[model samples]
Target: MDKLKGKGKEAVGKLTGDRRKESEGKADQAKATAKDKVDEVGDRAKGVTDSLRNDDK
Candidate 1:
């Protein structure tokens, strides 16, 4: 969602030649990427925990 919005903003910024908007859009994309990576790591950890618990049962 945010990544898509950021991309739109970036495209608009490029079209309008707005440097500030472009920078902001880039920042938003970076934030979204970091968040996605964190979520992926957390999901992997949860999967591992679930597998271990199931093994004990």
Candidate 2:
């Protein structure tokens, strides 16, 4: 996952003292978290829609 990769990148960045890499890794982790939240919302929406359809029968 992006988060895992980001953690590795961050560790490497710290070891090498590359601020840019550390920042990039943090960004990647944030982006991955946001994407996961969106997916969770979409899944919840789909479940609601399915429940509504069943009620109509």
Best by lDDT: 2
TM-score for predicted model 2 compared with the true structure: 0.96
Q: How many pairs in model 2 have backbone atoms within 3 A of each other, for residues 3 or more apart or on separate chains, i.e. clashes?
A: 0
User: Which lDDT value does model 2 have at 52?
Assistant: 100
Tens-place lDDT per residue, model 2, 1-55, is 9999988888888999999998888888998999999999999999999999999
- Expressed as tens digits, the lDDT of each residue in 1-57 for candidate 1 is 889888888888999999888888888999999999999999999999999999999
The worst-scoring run of ten residues by lDDT in candidate 2 lies at: 4-13
- lDDT, candidate 2, at 50: 100
Give TM-scores for every candidate, taking all chains together and pairing residue i with residue i: 0.91, 0.96
